[model samples]
Target: MADSLATWMPPLASLDDALLRYLDQTGVAVLVKDLTSGRFTAASPCAPRVLVASQDIVGQTDAELFDAVQAVALRAADQQAVALGTAYAGEHRIERHGERREYVVWRHPVPASGEQGPRILSCWQDVTEQRKRDVLVQATLAQLEEQQKANAELRREMQDNQVRDSVSGLYHRAHFEEQLRREADLSSREQREFAIVSVSIDGMDQIRETYGADSCERVVEALGRLLKANTRAMDSPCRLGGDRFTVLLSGVGLATAHSRMEHLRKACSQHIVAFNGQQIPFTVSMGVASFPHTAGSVEELMRSADRAMAASRAKGGNHLTLASIQFVPAT
Candidate 1:
């Protein structure tokens, strides 16, 4: 609640023309209260916007101008500012036309003059819209973070599903070759040994002719499962199309690779696939070779392993073979 500008202006200070225009035009509500009489002594032209319109606010107490609850709060803040002899700030919520609004109020105690006694200067600023915008920004940032995480998970799943052979669930030949090159480089650089094994289903042609293509697929799938089960997580097992498969064993030597492959060969020979109301038994032949033992390079190692596998199939099905060590003269 406020009075005419001329009546309240004289006590506070000498107001210049520019200061008078600013007080009239600004949205901030400025008011002064007399501490002794507990009544409003001065007000800006815009002060009426802070409360219900009244004809005159001069010499009016908060109880006469505002509701009971607001009156008590206003009185408390004024007393606190005067007692502290400094500026104090607080927030208040008011409802008008069924719409709730928020404001930040600041109060400062003005020293008593010759006859005016002490006064409290107060300014009120509306902050409802700024608070709403802050909430909206926080919610938007949270939603965006969730969406980014979801997209990253989706991309990982897609990569896992797309880079493997559908039937064997093992990496494709292209991926296998990439791994081969990487392993070769690592072994050469670190002076460490690793093994490569080439595998093929023995008597595959005869089995396909005797039991149809579905039977062949059943046998291949069974061999794939056995290979996966027998290999370590660090090993790379790949399906190189048709009945061919290969494994790369990291940090393994020739003897260890041969022992592991022999175990896998036995597992393949023992596994039976059930199909079309009949059980089909199958066998796989594998050849084990090591880097710097059987061959010096990736290409040479693969060729040597393939030759050994062919030799095993020549002997009989369900057998494992090891590539011969290359003899080199002392340099």
Candidate 2:
């Protein structure tokens, strides 16, 4: 293709080594032409791929490179670019080897003097593959959006499970377990005692049957409020699932634990949870245990508190009891 234009173009002029290197290395087709002389000067190696203009294109004018109609249109565009003294670019469709393809072309005017006359530098980029890639990008973007939404939902569920109870806004069982371990370690290291009080709503199965599901939710909320109101700042309160709550009272003895839990029970009994225009009355049973007094280890403390709570519930609902477990070593 370049061989054809070699004849129509003028004799090659002195060219810049860097410009030739740039054209050779670049992916697109580049060319230099003297508009005033109506002749081609230089072409990048990709000239054969992009320029199907004319094979016999050495000293020939634009009129010679293309047919009459195309020659006329190209000349008009060139004139406009030269007038602006800047690159004029646009997408163009042309037939090559019996196939029509799209190319983005730029015509930049280069000011020249003497015999060099006014020059035009040009390049053409094939955008067929680029269009295909753009479509794929849109599909990839949609897939990424879906993945992000799924990840967000997974994060929310994980957060709900780890730190908070979905219904009551209290610390859940996992948090309580972790806090218990930390508190036990701190108590042992400081040679101090902390109380573990286990509390559970009395006769929950009966209450749920009598008042329905929402009633249970309301009762739990009211109970959470009561715990918050009665417990001190250092206490760690948690919901250990299904109407059961436990508190780790830092630096508190068995007597203080009993007083606090007894006060909490009275408040819980007096407070009525209102739901759907009905006043729902509920009560809780509490069991208290202390480190090194009632139990030796975290497991022992939890078991002792649970046992005491169970005893309170067995006797009747809504009572607080102390579990007396003297720490004894094996013989």
Regions of model 2 farther than 4 Å from truth: 1-162, 327-331
Query: Pick by lDDT: which candidate is best?
Result: 1
Candidate 1 C-alpha lDDT tens digits along 5-97: 445655555545466557556667777888889888777767676553454665799888667887898888888888888999988876645
TM for candidate 1 is 0.60
Every candidate's CA RMSD:
6.1, 9.3
Give the runs in model 1 whose Cα sits over 4 Å from its true position. 1-26, 34-41, 48-99, 144-170, 197-237, 242-288, 304-331
Worst lDDT run of 10 residues, candidate 1, spans: 1-10
lDDT of 2 by residue, 269-325 (tens): 898888888889889999999997999989999999999999999989899989986
Per-model C-alpha lDDT, please? 0.83, 0.80
Candidate 1, residue 15: how far the Cα is off, in Å: 6.8
